[model samples]
Target: MKKILLTVFAITFFINAKAQSAEVAITKKENDTGKIYTSVEKAPQFPGGIQSFYHYLAATIVYPVDARTKNRQGRVIITMTIEKDGSLTDIKVVRGVSPSIDQEAVRAMSACPKWIPATQNGLPVRVLYTVPIAFTLGK
Candidate 1:
């Protein structure tokens, strides 16, 4: 019975992992500029840390009035270029929930302070970062 339970748990974990991988299709942008990289040796860090960044977003983000009124809720994925100077540029919506929510996500990201830029071989490089912002209505 112990062996059977362990096998079942392993199978369930594998299946769940596969399902999650299938749900998120990440297409890394391919470019030959030698300036922008999808994956670098060292990735950028948000001000303070990722947790602090989330807290900042939660505190600063204002849900769209139209989206709240329409009862629309989903995750909005935003892609932006973290420049070599720790500045963000080319902000865009990779996968948007709705127009209002999408706009808000972009707004929130745009308002972010500079980040610690990514590095490759001890040199700063522009890198692409994708962030998912979720919008949910209150109870």
Candidate 2:
């Protein structure tokens, strides 16, 4: 059928397109740690350290001044994965208040410094961690 053939063609095209980009490969590697290109000798610390990182980041983020980012605009809830290498990646708005606030959440995330990488079974391995940051304006 035409539909099946088109689907296969689309899949193949996407595959080839991904193979052609260095950024795509890097992003994919960042998502998946199974395929080893080089040894990630530097491992991040555990949840305790990540908690500390969050605490510090919370104090450091500059709340956006836009209408939606304001307290009057409601709350911004963001969920993102903190990778094993202590890198913050895949920031997405799980519960969004507004587009402006969503972008602010992402900006706040990017502003954060590197964290202690995560570990698995005593070895440094990439682990998926979830965090929710709520933006609330003052009283």
Candidate 3:
């Protein structure tokens, strides 16, 4: 009967939807490349802790002499790819600024110290994460 078929279809649809929880959906983060995040497994830290990575970078960045933005201020959006073993695999610039400033941003990123590592389900999984750093001259 048409009524019986429609009822069965509706029930099946709901069952399938419930089975596939919304939270379990494979979410492609800003720059997801099918990578996971590393877990905390006790690693060495920079001289003054993980925060030192920023300090070291700020000290190394050299603004371009011809930078149009006299303010010399912009944000560098960095997307980092971490391996399961807690190491940097790839670094990409998502939202980039001027070419000159962008290059400096990449240099600073490459010079960054090891991260504290990220985790998923309490296990070390490679993942891609985006981090933004604002650079202001003489700030």
Give each model's whole-structure lDDT: 0.69, 0.48, 0.53
lDDT of 2 by residue, 1-139 (tens): 3333233223332100111222223332543455321123333443465445445545555556675244544445554455556677666776676677667767876777766654434554443334455555543
Worst 10 residues of 3 by lDDT: 13-22
lDDT of 3 by residue, 16-126 (tens): 011122244344444654544232223223357533544565466666776645655666687766555556657888777777778877777677666555454455455
Candidate 3: residue pairs that collide? 35-126, 36-125, 36-126, 36-127, 37-125, 37-126, 37-127, 38-118
Q: Cα lDDT for residue 25, model 3?
A: 35
For this target, which candidate reaches the highest lDDT against the unseen true structure?
1
Q: List the residue pairs that clash in candidate 1.
A: none
What are the TM-scores, per candidate, against the unseen true structure?
0.75, 0.54, 0.59
- lDDT, candidate 1, residue 89? 87
Model 1: CA > 4 A from native:
1-34
The list of candidate 3 runs beyond 4 A from truth reads 1-34, 37-50, 68-71
Displacement of residue 122 (Cα, Å) in model 3 is: 2.7
Error of 1 at 8 (Å): 30
Pick the TM-score winner: 1
**Poorest stretch of ten by lDDT in candidate 1:** 13-22
The better candidate by lDDT, 2 or 3, is 3
